[model samples]
Target: MDERVDDDITFRRLEILLAFMETGNLARAAERLGTSAVTVHRALHALETGTRCALFRNEGRNLHPTEAAQALAEVAREVLRTMAEGIRATREVAGYSADRIRIGSLYSLTSRTVPAVVTGMKIRKPELQTELVLGSNADLLQKLRDGGIDAALMAVPDAASDVESEPLFVDDIFFAAPVGSRYADLAEVDLAACANERFVSLSEGFVTYGGFLESFRVAGFSPDVVMKTDDIFSLMNLVGGGVGFTLLPGRVRGVMPQQVQLIALQPKYLMRQTIALNFLRSRERDPNLLALLAVCRMARAGLS
Candidate 1:
């Protein structure tokens, strides 16, 4: 390409030229592009001036494309089509799905929060497919950073430069036990009072596990762990089966089994987790993320 053409030519100019070629007049081209006729004429004039070529010839008030313009329009059409394909292919190679969004979340959120958000997202973008990936908070964050997932729904992690988050809601930590357990009858559990109680906890890396640790730390003692599971559902099952007591977030209350009960923790031992949407800061402006974020805001409005 010549330096003059390179300096003057642009995607927008090409699009306007193609529009004019198809419409046969400035007013119709502007209408097709949803722009003013003056703007369309100005863009064409600028394009002609920049290219330093005879792209158009005036016949009364109408302008006709010259031979050079005709040839350039042919190339422009192919250029735009090829560029479109290239953009799509490049995004896929980068693991950025245009029609589907892979979202990472904690297993616990699968019960309600994730379902609600996914449904809302579908309603907003009917053509979009959603894939849910369940994992611990640490795992989810790592997946997001690695581009294995588009976004994550989990407890807000500590501040990091590479990630940005939008907090949806805060969930308080509670003491969970089987229905007939002595602690089940308590109005609010005094964490220290249950220090000697056997517990089944989610293993490390889980957001709930972090809350469990923090609440216990505040209570001034460590929990007696009889088992450590990888998922919150299993830990809840263990507690429901009377295997041991465990700490859980209030969000899990909806999914607690008939055999299990959650008791509020005493104020002194209170712990809360801020659940949020986490994504790479660089992708915050992505169209897919924008749609996901809109639904998240809707979820937050109902949750908060």
Candidate 2:
């Protein structure tokens, strides 16, 4: 027989051979495999034929595995184990069973929501590594759609067919001003009244920037934007140092320096942002995403 014929042995046949070897009895192996003794006997015989080598000898009503069978069984165990590991690794690379999950978010969320969610996820999955990617709301959404990140925490935008969102909380936009500004003493800011005020704002693409434009549009005139920043922290600092007044989300209230004060917009000019977790609709059932979704749900509950 050609020695290469051993390559013809299938994993299913090897499994049967290993089962028989481990249990040391045809009936016991069959019982272990949820099959009949006759089926196990036939599979063992076929395994020997496929390898073109004698692997068993009948003694009375029982069959005993030969030395060759024992050695082959050991190799088979290692092969099956390696195959299982390889499959798992492949799935992880495909993001189906990832060991690490990438999370995208707006820089503003770093203050409270992002940290809380990260801590909760780590506690729930001690082995899972979490990577936080910070960007503007539009940038984070783009990363999510491109599969550059697994999920995003941002202001929920207009719906997209490929993206699914779960709202975590709602944040009202506020007029951010320096503590000593004349508007600081007002009960609520009338944005129209601040039309001539110099403003510092997050640049285009940030959710807050969109809100800023919309709020001013509602106020019937745009404020003079003196500086536009990509970093929410820098924008807040600019406002704190009195570089200019700006429109900001409520989430930024306690995070800015004492020099910065956030006050409500007048009723007519009020705008609210719904902060949500967004991900590819297709990955909604992914295990890593499922864990994140659970953590986010708990966060929402706690906030409420």
Candidate 3:
């Protein structure tokens, strides 16, 4: 009977296995574990030797966990949870329980939505510490996946598998045209009416842009995009200049230039960009995450 239970391989091999299960690829798992594929391979070899069973099998380029590995995963998860709780308890006992909440947001939210939410949260829980990070939707999603942020406020993408999203708000998209434009006086207009008009748009990867494309698809026409800018304010400025009309969030009406007219669409192919509070489903039980979520929900209700 091998009683060498405290070997470093025991913990490290379990960590590698968990990483593999999360990513389903040796290279990605190794990257998450902060080691090379060779090290992960060696760790798996040690694990198989210690257990006297095959843990995984290579299927094409990906590694598939064997039935034994699948069974072990539940145990591994519990072990890791216990280890984490132990560390947390130790830290708490040492009077180091100042928890940190890390949050990420898209640029649009960072301007007003996130700040307002953070302010409201602080007023309610002054002792809670928080860190805010801002980036494009894709960048923020990647950061969340990498565990760099505990939660994020973003426009929910079409496909989000591992993330749990709670819809916070539905931001309506509108057309912003110059005040005196031919279509300015109309209460509503269809996209087909402006098919020949030049359109200013946000650069690729922006949620606004994504919504714009979807709206066009529903309207049965592709927009004639004449210029693309990353900044919503810049796009607004161009629309004010009569360079082109642009699709923007309803919230943007509050910041539009005096010369810009925001037209609500009729038969309203209303493209609602949904703002959601997203967090890794695996971390839903963390106290810090729960607290932040509570704060976010309160803030969202107040705003609504």
Model 2 C-alpha lDDT per residue in residues 6-102, reported as the tens digit of each score: 6448788788888999899989999999999998998888888877789999899889989989888999999999988998887777676588999
RMSD list, candidates in order: 4.1, 5.1, 14.7
lDDT tens per residue, model 3, 140-237: 78888887777889887667788988878888888788998998778888887788889989888788888889888878899888899877888889
> How many residue pairs clash per model?
0, 0, 0
Error of 2 at 220 (Å): 1.3
**Count of clashes in candidate 2:** 0
TM-score of 1: 0.76
Q: What is the lDDT of residue 197 in candidate 3?
A: 86
Candidate 2, which segments miss by more than 4 Å at Cα?
1-87
lDDT of each candidate versus the true structure: 0.88, 0.87, 0.80
RMSD in Å for model 2: 5.1
Cα TM-score per model: 0.76, 0.73, 0.67
lDDT of candidate 3 at residue 58, scale 0 to 100: 81
